[model samples]
Target: MSKDVQERGLEIRKSVLGAEYVEAAFRSADDFNLPMQELVTEYCWGAVWGRETLSLKTRSMLNLAMIATLNRPHELRLHVRGALRNGVSKDEIREIFMQVAVYAGVPAGVDAFRLAREVFDADKDA
Candidate 1:
């Protein structure tokens, strides 16, 4: 990609994750994980997240719901958080998780909720 595109991706990654988080990820990258970090910074946040077609708020919510429904509790927790940081309200998150319970299956949603609450608790202290 062009330098402009690469710069755009870095900007998007910083915007979505906060400079601290992105910096930590970048600084901590070892030889084994360096490529993955670059790919995530350039692709996930750079390309996919940089797209203007969907608002970050909408994308975060959709990602949380989908990951939760898919039984990926770890990702669900992280994205639930990203959704919050993207301006999704706590009540809105509750609604999405509740909906996930109905359409995605109760057990999966419950586990996701369990993980989400853990993230929320940590956020409260931070």
Candidate 2:
């Protein structure tokens, strides 16, 4: 990826995911994982998320749905927080997961709800 793309990706990643979280990920990167980090930063953040066609809020919702359907609990939890930051109401999140339940199957929906609840509880504690 080009420097410009990586730079833009870094900006978008920080904005959506928060500096602390991104920085923590970067800090944990090693020789083996650094390439993966660079790839995601440049492609996912820079190329896709930086696009103007979709608002961050919309992107966040899409991300939540996709991750939940894929049964990616960790990613879903992170995106739950991101969805909130992007202005997706908790009610909307609940509704989204409900839809996931219908389409993605009950197990996926149950896991998504579990992960989302954990994130919500942690946020409340924080």
Could you tell me the C-alpha RMSD of candidate 1 in Å? Answer: 1.7
Q: Once superposed on the true structure, which residue ranges of model 2 sit more than 4 Å away at CA?
A: none
TM-score of 1: 0.86
lDDT of 1 by residue, 15-108 (tens): 7666887788889999999999887767877788888999999988888888888888666766777788899988888888899999989997
Question: What is the Å distance of residue 110 in model 1 from its true position?
Answer: 0.6
Say which candidate scores most in TM-score.
Answer: 2
The runs of at least 3 residues in candidate 1 whose Cα sits more than 4 Å from the true structure, single-residue gaps closed, are none
Each candidate: RMSD to true structure?
Answer: 1.7, 0.9
Task: Give the range where candidate 1 is weakest over 10 consecutive residues by summed lDDT.
Answer: 73-82
**Best candidate according to lDDT:** 2
Prediction 2 global C-alpha lDDT: 0.92
Task: Give residue 8's lDDT in candidate 1 (0 to 100).
Answer: 83
